[model samples]
Target: MKTSRLSTALLIAYGIAILGFLYLPLVSVGLASISKARYLSFPIRKYAFGWYEDALTSDTVRDLLVISLKVAGVVTVASMVIGFFGALAFARYNWRFRKTYQKLILLPIFFPQTVLGLALLMWFNALGVVPSWKTAIIAHLVWIAPIATLVVSIRAFSFDAALEEAARDMGANQWQTLREVTIPLLMPGVTSAGLFAFLLSWGNFPLSLFSTGADSTLPEWLFAKMVSGYSPLVPTVGMLTVATSAVLVFGGLILAWAIRRLRPES
Candidate 1:
């Protein structure tokens, strides 16, 4: 009994340590956001919220937010759609060159983002395509869609083929079986993939760095500001971005809960 208690205590300590390791930096940034001094330092002498207000009211910040949102939103939707099909092909279908196709689809995910971004910039230039927020979406999709596919494929592999067969035997056509049986079963994975895609795209700096030529996302702007000149608003904006991601994560959880609740009733 004493051994079990000790084990449980150790596990709790380990869990707390892990959480602190993950979030301590963000906590420090949060503290800095409220620091009133122009230069940030630990054990802050003064505290104020004016930096957050300045960030919230800044036109540049607003533009960056809008660009980031647009890129993430588009990446989320596209990743879901592509992931759905890719997962089906990856795990459900057995066809010629399936292994090769899988490797090709996931190749971009393995490439260094900086190199990938640079290569993409050259490709865009060679094609006479202008780099912009639109290009950023394409770049993000190249990296994120494969990750989304991998997420959905985990769920897909466990799916019972018998259910699809049974639906077909029930006189349901391909589309109907896909809609009524396959999609509903796979929705959980798809939703999780979307959340991952959005968060990854929103926080991405390397891909957006080269791809968003004239335009800038929040992460890109933050990088530029951090390098060019120090601003008190840096931590403030960082906190805001962190807050937005947390809200989305919580919102996704609530949505998933609602779906689960509604499923049995329906």
Candidate 2:
């Protein structure tokens, strides 16, 4: 009992310490954004919403946000489509060099984003392609697709092959079996994979920095401000991003749960 109690105490302490280490900067930024002082200070003297107003109204921020959304949407769709096909190939097919193809697909997930960004940028420049939202979307797809593929493949492994086999035996064509039987069963996995892709693309920085255009994506815009100097406005943007992400991801999880609950039990 004493050993268990000690372990519990240590775990609690570690968790609290970790949270503090991670969130202290965010807390400071939140405080600074509302502080009346020109510079950040401990024990904020006064508070105001002026920084949030400035952040919301800034033309630069607005444009960056639109770019971020466009890139994220494109990345999510492309990643999901490529991932679905890859998952089907991996989960449902067998062939020589299968392991080699699997490794190639997953290689980007383990690669350093900085190296990936530089390599992609150089490749695009060599090809005479301009850095734009399209470039950002395509670059992010390379990294995010692997994770999406893995998610769907894991789901596929748990899947009942009986359904597809039954459809085939019932004279369903290959396309019909895939479109009507396989995909419906994989909806949960696909939705989760798309969400993951969206979040990654929305927050990715190094790749965005290299691939973004004159408009700039949200992360690149934020990075520019941070590189130039720290300001209260920065935290306001951070808070907004955090809040938006939380709402979206949480809402999605809830919706998925509700759908499962509403399904007819066999």
Task: Judging by TM-score against the true structure, name the best candidate.
Answer: 1
Candidate 1 residues 115-176, lDDT tens each?
A: 99999999999999999999999999999999999999999999999999999999999999
Please give the RMSD to the true structure for each candidate, in Å: 1.5, 2.2
Can you tell me which runs of candidate 1 are displaced by over 4 Å? Answer: 1-14
- Worst 10-residue lDDT window for candidate 2 reads 212-221
The list of candidate 2 runs beyond 4 A from truth reads 1-4
Tens digit of per-residue lDDT, candidate 2, span 15-42: 9999999999877877777776666678
So what's the TM-score on candidate 1? 0.95
Clashing pairs in 2: none
* lDDT for each candidate structure: 0.95, 0.85
TM-score of each: 0.95, 0.91
